[model samples]
Target: MKMNRTLFLITLLSTFAMQGQDSLVSNIQEVTQVADTVKKVPQRYKVEGVAAVVGDYVVLDSDIDKGYLEFQQQGVSTEDITRCQLLGKLMEDKLYLHQAVQDSIVVGDAEINPEVDQLMQYLTAEIGSEEKLLAFYRKNTLPELRSELFEARKSLKLAGRMQAKVVENVEITPEEVREFFFAIPEDERPVFSAEVAVAQIVVEPEITKEAKQTAIDRLNEMRQDILENGVSFATKAGLYSEDGSKTRGGLIEGVKRNSQYVKEFKDQAFSLLEGEISEPFETQFGFHILKVDKIRGQEVDVRHILVYPEVPQSSIDAAREKIETVRKAIVDSTITFKNAAIQYSEEEDTRNNGGQLVNPVTYDTWFDLTKMDPELSAKVYNLKPGEVSKIFVERDRTGKASFKIYTVTDRKEEHPAEYVTDYERIKELALKEKQIRAIEDWQNKQIKETYVNVNEDYQECEFSSDWVKTSN
Candidate 1:
């Protein structure tokens, strides 16, 4: 399905955060738009209908409309932003960038390089190749385009920081939550599904100890050869690297900051300096040796050759047996499920946090069972609170299947949400309200503080979604 910008961003962010590792992956197209009023635009990149020019930045009409269409395709509702509203947004972005520069809010290479890679990939994919990219966009190479994207990275990071500031301090109380619930009428209150809380002892059966060692040995060999021969990593990567980016040689793609990563992969990739190669390393995906090619701003580019650790039948049996042992321990109450999770679970996020299940959509400890994976929902929803589940295997979208044993830590049946019954949920609503209010407060603060000047044409334009009012 075509995803909206917001949804796409959320998905991308979630993926990177969950894995917390490093390796180059695929990228999607990224673009921005705004409204401009200037007749003779000075910028080389123009897609008609001048949106707004914020100092050195210009928001084009195409940016907004393209995003609008994308949102529409995704069934997301966005009340059409008038040209002026778009301009306001453009101005806001520029303002954020301006503030970021003043504060020296530098982005990490980890964040910027992946984004550059994604954009570059998309551009090359669209226009044909590296040569075509230069010919069509009048850009010499990827680095020049990456420089342009660096500015975008700054704006995005600043906006994110600003947003965090708005919601970071806001807190919701149980009483405030009740008020929020009551504020919504019965018909308006969104109904929830029967939800389940599930815990898991995960087993990724991709790597056998022997195969894993082999991968390590190979990487070590490759690393030694690179040092001995001084073979360019990118040239080596293109010719013989086993990683997915073999065609591009080992050049790291541009990425957004705090974006998805393989937990081990990301950490190591971000830690390296320019022109350095990492010792052979291993992640859930497999073993790799990395060579850092370049660093721009806070983003880094690298190439790697991955050697997969062979999956063994005995290894699967061993993993399952371990899971069963944990299950039996839970059954006997020798350990609490959460504690067992913390002790034995390999899944990073939950294992570190006592195995509390979080809803992917709401990020809540609770979830709507209906929205869960069919196998998981069926297993988890049937269990009462504090029940452990049998080992079951599930496949990701990529057809990569893994085994996991789940424990239902919590369960809630269908019921009307009320002040007393859904106290926490109500509180969450109140907190969300506070967040919205905080945003408005912040926007008003910005308007009051920043040098904002609305165009004369937009002076009388009525905005339906006004966060702050100006004496225009």
Candidate 2:
């Protein structure tokens, strides 16, 4: 099926926010017609009228029309969603973007262009070809479509950042959490899925000193080739880098100090001068040689080539034997599983916590079977509480191999939400409520100070924020 135009744009432009289309050319003429013989000008000047102006940004009628189309495209029943709701949302987006620009929140092209390239590539394949994609959007050239997409994406990022800023420091206290939980009536409480707490002990294959030196030597050779022979770093990275970013010449843009990268990787990246490449350094993943492309304030653009040392068959066999010994010790009651994990497991995040695998989404011990890792869920399906699974080989997306054994530490059947048992989840909900209130309060105040003008048609529509008034 041909993709919905607005839905495609929304998917390409934003993470969660849906934005309006900015098509400059349309054939439809809604106004009074002159002589039939007189050629009518295209709708860009007259028919595609402005719906509202928020601060410096204008929301067009086309934007509202596309917004409604986007909702329908997503299979949402828009029967209850009014034109007023759509207009209000677009205005709110504009307000946030305006404030973000005023506040000097930076989102550079280095961050946006990569997304544009990816989206264009995806749209071209889905819509059949580049020409068809452009024709579908009524654009004359690729740059024109890209420019509109960039602006839309930038606006989405700005609004998101501004909203995040409002609630960045908002927190809920235990008292607030209790109050929020109690405020809900008994019957309105949420039901939780059956949950199981999973734990694991992992042992990765040990690379020999010879293998380690080989990888380091290989990186050194590549660095020298690039510096002396003047080979392109990107070309080398595309050819030899094992990291996922290899496709883009190992480019990882918009890296902040607090980005989720390993400490060693961040330290190596930040220590380099612009356009300078580093010697091989080791992170948890592998050895890497990094190049700093550009630094904008606290953010840096970087590219790196990752190379993992060759693990000999002997090393793999030895790791398997070592893990087998640990499992045998637990099975024979010579060592407890938690003690074994603390002493022998090599996965640092779980080793210190008795190998307890916290769910990344919930930040808790519980894993819902439906959403749990398929391999893990399958292995633990028949395991009783406290029984350990047979040792299994695991390979990550990068093909880094490891051996692991799992244990189901606890289990609970599906149940309605309970206060004591689901305190963390409840706390999250309360904090979210507090954050939403904080954002709404900020928006309310900002709307009073900002320029807002709605068209006469929407003048009578009630809005969540005071949108009809202009600031004194």
**Per-model TM-score versus the true fold:** 0.62, 0.65
Judged by whole-model lDDT over C-alpha atoms, candidate 1 comes out at 0.61
Candidate 2: worst-modelled 10 consecutive residues by lDDT: 22-31
Residue 337 in candidate 1, Cα distance off native in Å:
8.5
Best prediction by lDDT: 2
* Candidate 1 lDDT, 1-472, residue by residue in tens: 1122233334233333333223222222121111212222223334565545444455566655544443343333546434445445555556556555555666665555555555566556556677877765457766676676566554566666655554678887767776677788988786656777677777655465677787688778778878899867767667765543654576665533555677777777778887778988877566778876777676666677766655678777777778788878889999998888888887898888777767655677776775554555777777888777877876542234567777777778887776666766667557756775675566556555554444444556544323234522
Runs in model 1 lying further than 4 Å from the true structure: 1-46, 54-56, 69-75, 78-98, 102-104, 114-154, 171-194, 238-285, 291-304, 312-356, 359-364, 368-401, 405-408, 448-461, 465-472
- Model 2: per-residue Cα lDDT over 1-472, one tens digit each: 1122232223323332222211111111211121221232122223568889988989998787666654553444455656677777788778888899889998876667656655555555556776887876779987798788778777767787887787778988899999999999999997877779988999999889999899999999999999999999999998999864675788888887887678999998899999999999998788999999999899899999999889899999999999999999998989988999999999999999999988765567888886566567899877889898999998864577899999989998788889999888788778866765676688889898888888887788777667886522
Q: Number of clashing residue pairs in every model? A: 35, 0
User: After superposing candidate 2, which stretches have Cα over 4 Å from the reference?
Assistant: 1-53, 56-94, 106-161, 168-183, 251-277, 291-303, 321-325, 328-334, 359-383, 390-392, 419-428, 452-472
The CA lDDT of each predicted structure is 0.61, 0.76
